[model samples]
Target: MNTTTLLFEAPGPRGRRRCRLFEIISWAVLAGIAYLVIQTLDKRGAFDAAAWQPLGQLGVWRQLGVGLLNNVRAAVVGMLLSMFFGCFLGWGLLSGHKIVRYPCRAFTDLFNGIPVLLLLFFTSLALPAWGLPLTDFWFLVIALSLYSTAVIADLVRAGVQALPRGESEAAAALGFSGLQSMWLILLPQALRMMSPALVSQMVIVFKGTTLAFVLGGYFDLLRAATVLGAYYSRSLLQAQGIAAVAFMLINIALSQTAAAIDRRERRRYGVPPIGTGSRSPGMPE
Candidate 1:
């Protein structure tokens, strides 16, 4: 075998030429598209310096800060609630009793199937008619929590179910109750194994806070941008671009933190580098 073929099957000379041609064509197409977009935006005054001047104002910065705080508050509350309730529902779904498990399973399926926007609308609008008068802040949090609860419940369930059967059996042999074994042995391991996924869900929860703009009462970053745009006499493009940068910075930080934690966890557990599947002996068959 050729030294060059050690890592993978070597491409023939014609195949290599074809690959080079494809790469060149793809880059050229992408560059052309980018140039067109930049040109169009420039023509539309999206790059105007005057429109972005308001971003330097103290009052404008304060408004953005308040909006960001509201978003953070809702996301944090929802994430905590989701983790708590999701864990309970996940454990219930794995219970031996059909009465406990079936209801949890049904609720998970129902909520998970519903769109997040619909959930937010239902909580914000319909709930008041149903005699639950919630403020927009609470409504947003509840809506996000409800949707994330279903998703996190499924993640928890999969995490727990992925454990080896012997772990449970050994606990039973040691005279531990099923619940005790789950609490003492299984839940902790499952949580560690699923930490990366839970962090991802938290990021989703935070991003979903943007949809609170539809509620009218919630003053999130997007809503703030819209208000600023109106005040600046049709500077919507500039305000929106600033808002986009804020979101990009925040979500990028969150994603990087999550990735770092995941890498550390994988290293600690000696998991594979690509990290999709488990290499641990304790994992389920």
Candidate 2:
């Protein structure tokens, strides 16, 4: 039996039958919903071949692909910025000095709590209004960076917190300065431990690229789809559907990568992989 079975009783034969019944019912309900949706969309001529014609045009895809590249660029730049600032902010949160701690806490709480769209407005519009005009590209990137940094800060702090207390104590005993210890010892290990969370957060950053549509300066994938829809009204639904599919595929890839990293970390750290019956020493049977 696996650890899960040891932890909780497995269902009996009758329970399996009930589960099968539930599965069937769920599928039936979903099929009914799908049929209803298809009928409604058909009434609106959404399934007409003309409406989907734009998807066949090479130019439409080329435009969307360019926009997709922009989305990737923004996500990459923004995520890098977040990682950089978040490392310092994470250190600030953990610092002994009140001067560092208070400011980091305030910044983390402030941005983490605010809606990202508001930040986009501030970066893309408010700054320009105040005579700090930034390109739409920078605006989107900066907004994503600001919004995601707080989350990355929490990830860093959590990684550090998860380390054995002796790690820091050992550094102190070796006559190392605080910064030296962090740079030479603590950060490397902490980053490895938190790699999975950090990778998962990249998915969030990538998804946030869609918010560029509201700010109107950046030409993210969603914005491209919007323009295509406006120019070809009949293709609106198809364009949106395609964009949704693209997002789903990318997010799935990111999620799978995170899961793989998590598995690797578990093995490297000597934790029993999920579904294995093996348990660590002192784990209750």
Candidate 3:
């Protein structure tokens, strides 16, 4: 009997060629679609100087700033409030007492199940009858916070669940109280794991500020664009262009902020560098 050893090889030149070909085809299709869109817009005069004049006007920028300021204020307030509520609710849910956990779970589920627009409408309209003294902006902020909090609560709960049981057992072995174990040992690690989800929720809350239009205020980017379009004789394209630019700017800002926070978390926790086998910079040995 003769024994022969066969060396296994990773995907080679042929595999690489197929991947390159696939990428080229994907890019070609994308470029073709973009060209077709441009041609269609050009035929419709969408790229004309007159068509884009509204965007060039200085008043448009001022209007955009005012609208953006209001929305930013609302988003910031809502995000802060939502984070507070979420942390509390999450803590309650993981308190190890059914009475505390069940109610929190119920509330989170109830709020998450509701449509954001309906929640804003009810807050702005129904709450006023009960003498809530809530303005449209405030009402919208409250609604957004409540909705976003529910989502954040779930993120917190998942983070807590992902924590190792040994940590809690060790804390118990050390005679640490339950609250102490939670506050010092569990929550910090959980918060680090939860940061990405919180940032995503923040982006959603920021975008959700656009629903303020339903509350009868011209305080959001969408309403501002609509007003500008009305002034320009109902040019839907102009309105859409304004809104697109505004939302793009907002999303870019949020993405940058999230990236910064993620970097900070990695540095703080000394987590291993992504895709590297080495231990992260701040992690314990």
Kindly give the number of clashing pairs for every candidate: 0, 0, 5
What is the lDDT of every predicted structure here? 0.85, 0.86, 0.80
Best by TM-score: 2
Query: Ten residues in a row with the worst lDDT in model 1?
Result: 272-281
Q: Cα deviation of 89 in candidate 2 (Å)?
A: 0.4
Encode model 3's per-residue lDDT on 72-183: one tens digit a residue: 8999999999988887898888888999999999999999999999898889888988988767888988899889988878777777776779999999999999888877
- For candidate 2, the per-residue lDDT at 10 reads 81
Q: By TM-score, highest first, what's the ranking?
A: 2, 1, 3
TM-score of model 3 (CA atoms): 0.76
On the 0 to 100 scale, the lDDT of residue 252 in model 3 is 81
Tens-place lDDT per residue, model 2, 36-138, is: 9999999999999999888899999998998888988999999999999999888888999999899999999999998888999888878899898889898
- Can you give the lDDT of residue 266 in candidate 1? 73
Question: Worst 10-residue stretch by lDDT in candidate 3?
Answer: 272-281
lDDT, model 2 = 0.86
Worst 10 residues of 2 by lDDT: 273-282
The estimated TM-scores of all candidates read 0.86, 0.88, 0.76
